[model samples]
Target: MDMRNEATHIARQDGARAASAQQGSAEFLTFRLGAEEYGIDILRVQEIRSYEEPTRIANAPSFIKGVVNLRGVIVPVVDLRVKLGCEKVEYNGFTVVIVLNVRGRVVGAVVDSVSDVLELSGEHIKPAPEMNTSVDTSFITGIGSVGERMLILMDIEALMSSADMGLMDSAQVLQ
Candidate 1:
């Protein structure tokens, strides 16, 4: 089957499995950017907070909005929409910061807004499409079907390790 067809079929099967396994499944924290919804494993989420103005870093990429003081540790914040190359939009009442701990690093992801936490099964995850957007698909764990909405499951470790993100090089952060 073609990629699209395969993806569709997988989505359908995943939906069916999810419907039956809804009673007992792993939880994911869902969030949005523009119209697209995304999710991360709840195990990685440390906290969720209102959008805070971060200290800008020199020579950092556009998506890297520098670090924010979370308690005492400075954590870098990444704008999900910009990182995904989504169209820029004005930040209004919906902006939020999803603090995540991935591979021993605590980073905050700036998303449009958080939706809700969902329980999903492994069978309900579809592999990401290959040769799609410029954003590395390897960072995608799978595609989750939550009711009528589709949530992109992110691989937090892979995303944190990605060279382009510049997170792996972070040594001494502001205290």
Candidate 2:
């Protein structure tokens, strides 16, 4: 029957599409900072949890929002909005902590809210724009776009492990 033949053709087409998507695209977990959106590699994400007040540590950095005990493991929470220099930072019902594993250390990143996971092909991503010497843009891998939405693709591992971040002493300075 012609109808049966058409259904088989449709199934083949769908299978091909799924195969190409798997080979050519990477998945990013999207989240909000202030007004802008950001994307991080989904592999780095451990879990998303409701925001909670963390124990304040003495003499820690301003952006470091203290630490929270996650199943007996203390995770240092960082307000990404503050670290990224957002104009305003507010915590409400929608706020969440994105627990991430960075260089074998588990840390929590506070964000406004999570959007969804996106599979973006290479063509959908653009290289990060160049900035002046004073600004630090090294952790920005690229910019990703889907329809009208634009996402700042971040290399979270690099940002969290860098010496300046002070979250983890990953790169040792031979001084």
Summarize candidate 2's per-residue lDDT along 1-175 as a digit string, tens digits: 2554444445444534554555578899999998899999999999999999999899988889899999999999998988888977679999999999987789999999999999988778765655434556667777888999999988898778777778766343221
Give candidate 1's TM-score.
0.78
For all predictions, the C-alpha RMSD in Å is 6.2, 13.3
The regions of model 2 sitting more than 4 angstroms off are 1-23, 171-175
TM-score of each: 0.78, 0.83
Against the true structure, candidate 2 reaches a TM-score of 0.83
lDDT of 1 by residue, 1-175 (tens): 5565556546655644664565456789999888899888899999999997899999999999999999999999999889888899778778999998877789998999999999887666665655544334656656888578888887666676577887875452221
- Checking candidate 2 for backbone clashes, the offending pairs are none
